[model samples]
Target: MELDEFDLALIEQLRVDGRASFESLGTRVGLSRTAARARVQRFFDSGVLRVAAMVHPEFEGIHAFGHVSITVHGRASAQVAASVAQLPDTPFVSVVSGRHSVVAELRSPDVAHLSDTVSLIRSLDGVQSVDTLILTHLLKEPHIPAHGPGRPEQFDETDRRLLNLLHEDGRMPYADLADGVGLSRGATRTRVLRLLGTGVVSVTGMVNPTALGMTQMSGFQLHLETDGTTALSVIGRLEQVSFLARTLGRCDAIGTLITRARTETVDLLDRMRAIDGVRDVQSWTHLELVKEQYDRRPLRANGAAHGAAASR
Candidate 1:
């Protein structure tokens, strides 16, 4: 469905704060509370927007995560890509045109499981070689909340359950959230606020880029001549980059670029190349995003979360 200005505005507001009240949404977009609620429901029913919770792995004691680039033999790229996307560990998988045929993001609660998953990928038919980029720091992630200066507050079992419910439906009403976790509405609201305030989790709306008319998306790897701190600051200012991270592997950092057209991608690449400290930049055009979702491991029991994810 084609989105108009009001639809876009509502989407943008939800992206900033998915739990914003209908009154606030309507006020911002010049609609009545009833109208705003109806519009949001329409977007959800149409699959144009998904509001979900993203929990910080570090806060939950699940730390292993990185990117894997796979080179495949001639006709096998499609088969291999499909196979990788089915794995529980891979949150993001895409077929791209570049030196590597497929790229995926892997997340596991521990290193051993991660290593085993890598071995499994290497054993796949048509897989020639696999390259791993261990993420050292996540500078920016679209739906995931950034854990700013302070430490995360301690949470209990009830909090975990609340997070899981939020992951299932970010815009779930306070009364419903309270019922699920067996807490009073007022108390539940306070806990939810604390979690959001501490950056342990974020409940936000994620728009389908294609639905928003962003037709071109690519993954980029950068090798910088100087230390990454300054370069990171500069790169972070660009709105097109949805995800950015410092890594240890073939490149100093990796990020994703989403643009409206191919021309915009070219322009963005040229601008990135012009940054003072960038030595070289490699990018792969995303032919298809087979899978893309924030990790849901935190919602699962640790024992059950094993068996997939790893680096080369």
Candidate 2:
């Protein structure tokens, strides 16, 4: 779909505050509430945008977080990726062109869960090998800064209920949320704002790159000749980059890039190689995205917890 200036502006504002009221959003984008609501509903109906809550796995009792690279023995890489995507602990899965046939982001509640996931992947038919890159620290994630205030010791039942409601719909109205969480409107507003300000949660809009005319999603694993900070300083500035992380593994750093055309991907790679400190770069163009979920945590009816079996 072609997005005009107004649509773009609305999207930008929603990215900052997904739960912004239609009246407030309309005011910001120079439209009436009815008009803005229509545009947003259209975007949603067409699957162009989604507003949802996302939490850092670490704060949610997740004991492990990392990327898993899988190699397939034959032409069954796509099938293997599909199988891995069904695993509950994995939230991101893609078939790509590179040394590894498939790559997925994994979140586990503990070491045992992580081990089970690894074993399951290894036992899959046509699987050749698996390599994991554990994330020691996050330099940047989504639009939020990685370094933030410390996490609270624990969440009460009310907080969990609020989080569950937001998980289902980040744009849920305060009155509805207050009803769901058994809080007054003012209290609900304050609690939600505090959760966002403290980095306990994030509510934002996510759009598929293909929906925006950027069809190619690729991964770049960088072996840097210079310090990671220097390399990231150069790469992180690029607008096409969606995810970036410094790692402790075979590659010094890795990142995902989105581009509109094959030529653009080539040009991007060339520019990346030209960076003074970038020693080598391997590009993996995604062939198929088996699964991608911004919010991996599962919500419970009682709001007792998050984390459930993986969904296909």
The per-prediction tally of clashing pairs is: 2, 1
Q: Model 1: which ten-residue window has the lowest total lDDT? A: 303-312
On residues 180-216, what C-alpha lDDT tens digit does candidate 2 reach at each position?
9888999999988877777768888877677889998
The lDDT of model 2 is 0.79
Checking candidate 1 for backbone clashes, the offending pairs are 114-309, 114-310
Q: Tell me the spans in candidate 2 whose CA falls farther than 4 Å from its real position.
A: 110-116, 143-149, 299-312
**RMSD, candidate 2, Å:** 2.6
**Best-matching candidate per lDDT:** 1
